[model samples]
Target: MKFTFFTALILLFAPLTSYSLSQISNPNYDPELAEKLGADDYGMKSYILVILKTGENTSINKEMRSNAFVGHMKNINKLVDQKKLIVAGPFGKNNNDFRGIFILDVSSIDEANLLLETDPAIKEKYLKAELYPWYGSAALSEYLESSDKIWKVNP
Candidate 1:
């Protein structure tokens, strides 16, 4: 009976104790900004990280492949404009089959998969997407404004 009561107390308080320990007062903490960015108490939120890999469809004609990738880039721009994609970039030449990545500002794998379907590269099997849940700073989207200014050439 005593052990059960002690265990209950520990379980009840553990989350509050850990939460308090993890929270450090920040001088620059802005509640309004955090709320606008959909941040949690930690100023972080869930996202779907998609790793694009080379697909098995090697028989596709060069023109079809080119067209698919063109659609892919356009779809990326569209997603960024819609604020659904926070980050998207291709990996440099590497031994791994990874072709690119997209950090999608979505909560569920289902939502990410739906968004990815808009990309012709993934739909046409030119690229395969592997999705994982990611936790990142909610402020990540803020970088896009500056990124648009600095990019002299559109990729």
Candidate 2:
């Protein structure tokens, strides 16, 4: 069979393309860690992601805002210590209507909702939690372990 120039080019690159794809799978794959991380065939696991948005009750009083936020951060620290909260951060410079988000390592959205309720910001109605079912890499669970080497935030 005669092949066109483009077809010949594709044939030449096909093996290299497949080789590049297979390289993504590590040679030192860990089966135990894969199972423990809830990784599926795609190496992704379900998570409850909570978006912290400004509630209907906007803060006019600076003291109340500071108090609630302080408590909210303390609540986040508590969850981190428990290893229930995987990732938390603000969406600054992204856009309006979004303050921050929390990616919980909990098993269910109900658990994540209850955990968010402990935040003073959510409890006081200063910040509302919008929970969503999300799927992300199982390796995301390792962030905190290597975070200490990054830098410390002095309060």
Candidate 3:
């Protein structure tokens, strides 16, 4: 019984110990980068506002839009893995002003732009993405403190 309990405790704490050791050894190990890349994969969320152009709008049929949404959904997992996008969805009825929004977990506005460049809709002129720096509620403000990563408000 004692042996089994000791083994279980070691197993439970082994990862924590390793993480602590890594942090100690690499004093510059960025908490933000770690959070972005670690196994837990927790990342700061920021909204990407998309505006659809009026004149050259690529409004395909409803069926095609549905199919495209499905295809976009399929590629989302890869985006998350790359820490480019976290969550994305179209706005509801009352919020039709913008075309859509993508919540991303990138490190900078430049990174966000790169990610936006990958979208077929944006590439094809169906939409254009403008990133905005988001400061979440009081409980989640730490993630938004990185000046280099945060987007600037447009005048």
Tell me the TM-score of each prediction against the true structure.
0.85, 0.77, 0.45
User: What lDDT is reached at residue 123 by model 2?
Assistant: 89
CA lDDT of each candidate? 0.94, 0.87, 0.55
- The model with the greatest lDDT is 1
As for candidate 3, its clashing pairs are none
Task: Write the residue-wise lDDT of candidate 1 on 26-55 in tens digits.
Answer: 999999999999999889999999999998
Which pairs clash in model 1?
none
Candidate 2 per-residue C-alpha lDDT over 52-133 given as tens digits, one digit per residue, 9 for 90 to 100? 8888777699999899989988998899999888999988865567889999987788888888878888888988889999
Could you tell me the lDDT of residue 77 within candidate 3?
A: 52
What TM-score does candidate 1 get on C-alpha atoms? 0.85
Better by lDDT, candidate 3 or 1: 1
Q: Candidate 2 at residue 37, lDDT?
A: 84
Model 2: runs farther than 4 Å from truth? 1-26
Model 3: per-residue Cα lDDT over 39-147, one tens digit each: 2323334444333332245676777556654555555556766645555556555544565566665546777788766765565555666677653322132343353
